[model samples]
Target chain A: MTDGIPAAPGTDAWFHDGPDGFVLLAGRCTACGALSFPPRPIPGCPNPDCDGLEQHPHALSTTGSLWSYTDARYVPPPPYPRPPDTEFSPYALAAVELDAERMIVLGQVAPGVAVSELTVGMPMRLVPGVLVSSAGVEERVWNWRPGA
Target chain B: MSRPDSVAVLGVGMHPWGALGKSFVEYGLVAARAALADAGIGWRDVQLVVGGETIRNGYPGFVAGSALSQALGWQGAPVASCYAACATGAQALSTARAHILAGLADVVLVVGADTTPKGFFAPVGGDRPDDPDWLRFRLLGATNPAYFGLYARRRMAIRGTTEADFAAVKVKNARAGSLNPYARFRAEVDAETVLNSPMVSDPLRLLQICATSDGAAAVVLASEEYARRKQRDAVRIRAISAITPEYPRTVPDFPYLASDSAAISPPASRTFRESLAWSAYESCGLGPEDMDLAEVYDLTTAMELDWYEEIGLCAAGEAEKLLHDGATALGGRVPVNASGGLSSFGEAIPAQAIAQLCELTWQLRGDAGTRQVAGARAGVAVNQGLFGHGAAMVVAHA
Candidate 1:
């Protein structure tokens, strides 16, 4: 286990080989062992019964259900990359329900995923996707796709 | 012991709302000066100033309190600019009210003004992975009209709310707005015109949506003791509530949400909008049955239908039926949007909430001509939008 990876990865296996067979990382409360994604920054566990401050990082399951979806019709302002001369296709946005994490993480769906076909309870899997860097450096963003 | 301070609305001013060329700051400044003059004070006399922020304008997104403060001749009064999305103006007013209630200042001015971009306020550009507003627009291609369509369609499916019913609301507001000379659209229209008008989205037409306009509204609020000392009109602002949505705002649940989840626990009380006004009522010690008149954020024709229920006039699906029966008309049980609302007046964002206050103040004082409620003594104003925000305020004559 590579300890102390600053700026925790959303999925555990994200950096191991860079999520082609991507897996997400979450942290579990060492005291209660309750798993959480986007890992808790505060050392104390969220569980009411636990008094522990130590939170150890753990890998979370990548497969989950598509919570909901919508197609964005607007461009987002900064901290996000924008491609000039690239006619951006309006893409599908979805929130996937990762149960073990007990939370919903929102992400852009993979290319050509029809919003009409997506259902509230449909299963989804997170995969490594292209970020198309601002300075011509291809960074990666997480995306969910139907039928893992 | 902190002695509570009550606020009095002195001067209320509104510019004729429409597609004007002037910047929002200019429009708001004119109204601010007019309100100050109405309060028998100059801009320099005000101890504090607050501005409701806007989206289309270049002002708020840049520097707002300074934006208007500079427009009003750099008085250098303590300033705050609030952005509560659709609830902006009320949020602005709420800030001043808080200051007054806390005895921080005796006299304050609240202003909301906007020169809106025509068509819908679309999301800003770029492939943003982190933003929900951009995500909804990009992924769903959901224009503001799409949500309007969804609500209208839902009303039609369940409430028996027809296109004609929605049209009637516009017709009523237009006829009323025509008499005011302050409304953007004055031409009286029939349901036929609404039916025949080109469809911009699924169920709503061009006429059904309030147009973007250039406008400003301002009200000078003074502490109760301060108002008596100044010998000005002593009107009291009862309550202002800015409430956010519950944990999981769902779609079949929320017009803006993409979809709903089957897992999370449902809201224990009322829907988000209903609870917002309900809390306001509890705070103010009044109920919907006691309201003399109301100015709801009628962003769309169908939205007005929902507001009817949210304000407790009727049940969720009964708004359309109530509309057809003439219960919410100009002369109905409770005359809604008595000042042409955002329905007759296209949304002016920051200014819109204050504009609602202006109408309520007039109606309560029995000054609203033609559109006035017969004996309007108590009024409420409600507005909500984008960032899971909702606002409501109660106003009554002393």
Candidate 2:
């Protein structure tokens, strides 16, 4: 519980610091054993047939392989809190394959990692980072760093 | 698939795709009036009007159907507005068809127009945590081009597609665009120019991606019986399919942070884009080999290659080969984007899908002067919008 480190204000349900460190939160259906991320109150499973009404909170895998990657060279418009164009720098994004969940999750790559350093199938691990810092309050977010 | 009764496209009109500083209504009116005149029918003869809604304009754009009807001097026609991102025009056509088939109205006018804002299209205002569109921008700063870049990079890694293959798409489409007066970018581009352009996203240069433009398109559709009565030789719409991706969708589409986990249910046999084409083919009782021409959404040069496979024009991973063989050129077996595609026309959001059909209608009628495909009989238009909205239409000469 450090000042600069907290689950991104409203996204606490999606990511949290587990015993092993940052892990994605998910929901597992008790009836059909289906797993989904961004935990939701269950009365339904994404599966059409299974009448799975009950779901319990589950922690997702912390590491995954890079499925794909790209860099945002242009400044995204409003609501993104982008810095002025002159001070803007591109950041890399990675789509990681969470093998356990059998799904691909997207996130920004850890700061300072250029696009050239990344490759498909490269190992990546989830970690906490700052989305934005304002008025002494740091809005925490998740980043995928190159590692196991 | 059972054949639904076909609808006849009596007329097609468009306000040229460019950065025209005009309101959406003005554009819509121009296209609508031209379509009505082309059909040899008065505006008052139209019984129903369907409009593709634009997200840029606040209240007026939202109620586009009524707003456009009002601008055209409301004759008490029932109005409906639809929003489906870039597929908005196709959805509006679908709505008009539903009315025509249900015996609600015989003649319906469909219009779509947009005055796109400059720069990257951002999410609507506010910090509503529930909105995924806002979250992607706020959390990852992922612009639309970023998503396109990710897909492009994935295609290269998986299929070994080269940068030259992508530049070829621009060259071919731009050549066709030069012949199209409605297209914004009329000059043909070379591979060298595309390669030298500034990189908007990795593996994609400025020339490779479509720019946002202000444009409008309109089409007048009438029942088969009505067309016969009017003695109008019109392009017939055999089928229009608007299909969404099924559950356990493995591919991460735009505006979504994560794809549905395949841990529970397996992904569908066919990809989303493939399903869209299949639905159109099944409904029309026709396959890719039967099509004389096609108009596909080329938001990016790489995307056009992907569409070649999705629409069954070529086998999977063979899109680059199709391009290499000149199979997709104007004189090839099946010409694609004869209307210059989004690469030349850019994107007008709501108007894009309708503009695709306009190209098909003209091509099928042998009226596409300079860019005409020889003796074109059947044509298809395919487009996919954000949030799983996929659309395809089959048009044939009557």
Candidate 3:
């Protein structure tokens, strides 16, 4: 995997691969009609009355609106990243609105994006980002950010 | 749930909560033995054992039941381990309670123990987007403190709580913890000390949150007949409720979220924590107002305020007023965290819930020396499992 790909981004297989080779996925309740982006996995619907079960794969919107953003400081432990230096550049973590599922998804802003530049209600897209190593293996991951 | 076969706590034990410089199994074994001794029984009397899990131990949480039993000397009991994040202790005790309550075993030993990581607990290593806990730490760098921070902020927004109001909790719990020999930070703190501490998260200083500790706690639950046969003032676990989150857990809870409802609806205004206590009350025919003493999961100083409302100590937005008015303190109308709570003991995960009972059992029995609630006859312990879950146990003596 190249560190920076202009159009192609993403490292997982839930979402259908596109021209840029971005793969996406979401969570759908087979027991009921609920659709979620990252996917909801509880014993059931979490919706008290719904009591739905079996969280199956659902498709997520490739684009959405920014719900909120915060400049998070601190280098997350392993299974995450270990910045070569201890200097953990605060990244703007955001929850994006995917109106399709009526749910919110969270992701990191693309590597070069600064925290100050982002705002609530900003339009954003699901872009491919570097996948850090996981479970002793390297992989690509997806991130959401404000559109250019 | 039945009179024919009822469950009784026959054994109780624990190691002081702190950097005990020991392994999980060792601590667990010690606590187990204490329970056996307290119940006037032997490990061999236990027909089954259930252990709470700890992630750091790698393999134990899922397989520690037999490990603990073996540590206590190969008693040949059926062993089971459970993992429910913080609620593991209650689950373990609940398992034992079921065994006796179901007439499967006349005597059972339930144990939960953990040696926690020093720093803010993080998800298992690796960049697995599929894992929400890991993703939150990786993508947002939001450690447990961040979530605590969010809750503190929201409490302020929704309830008009202030930093001083939150600090008052630390002062109260610390003073109580100071009297408990098993506590980690025994020094009584003041609101000023809390305000001056380094800020881990906005509106929450370092002293405002619980630390990680190494500890173990065990309880021996027996059938009612077993208790009657022994026929002493044996503490009886009147109720155990392990309830899940409800839809729209809508209690203004985004503060704990590193992200939003990527999955389920927030539970309605009736939170799982609230419902958890409700279930216990239903089972015992009691309510918060009737509680003589309480042991709440003070995961964070601010979270204690949230639990106040959840357990029905007071109505929503009234916890701050209660804290300031000294109604929840040792001398308050209904004393809470009389054993100093998670704030004083730090969190030992699996051991915490059972430990809460250990304190209450001692208090209600009038054995608690300095930290005893004056005439505490009925007590409750409330805890939460991971991914939005809750556990509550009500204990009363006859």
DockQ of each: 0.09, 0.71, 0.24
True contacts kept of 2: 0.76
Candidate 1, lDDT over the whole model = 0.71
Clashes of 2: 0
lDDT of 2 by residue, A83-105 (tens): 33336668899999999888888
TM-scores of the models, in the given order? 0.76, 0.96, 0.83
How well is each residue in A1-148 modelled by candidate 1, as lDDT tens digits? 2222322112233233342455655556677675544455457754554677887766656888765565544443333345555664556666676665555665667878866667666799876565543344445556779875
Model 1 clashes, total count? 22
- With candidate 1 superimposed using the best TM-score fit, by how many Å does residue B150's alpha carbon deviate from the native? 2.1
Give the better candidate number (1 or 2) by DockQ: 2
User: What's the candidate order when arranged by decreasing DockQ?
Assistant: 2, 3, 1
Question: Candidates ranked by TM-score, best first?
Answer: 2, 3, 1
Worst 10 residues of 3 chain B by lDDT: B251-260
What class would a CAPRI assessor give candidate 2's docking?
A: medium
Model 3 per-residue lDDT at A58: 59
Candidate 3 per-residue lDDT over residues A1-148, each given as its tens digit: 3344322112233345455555457656676555544455344553445667777775566788775554445454554555442455555555566765556565667887865576556798987665443332334556777883
The sequence of per-residue lDDT tens digits that candidate 1 reaches over residues B264-377 is 244337767887889888987888888878888887788888899988988777887777787777788888887877767888888888998888887877778888789777
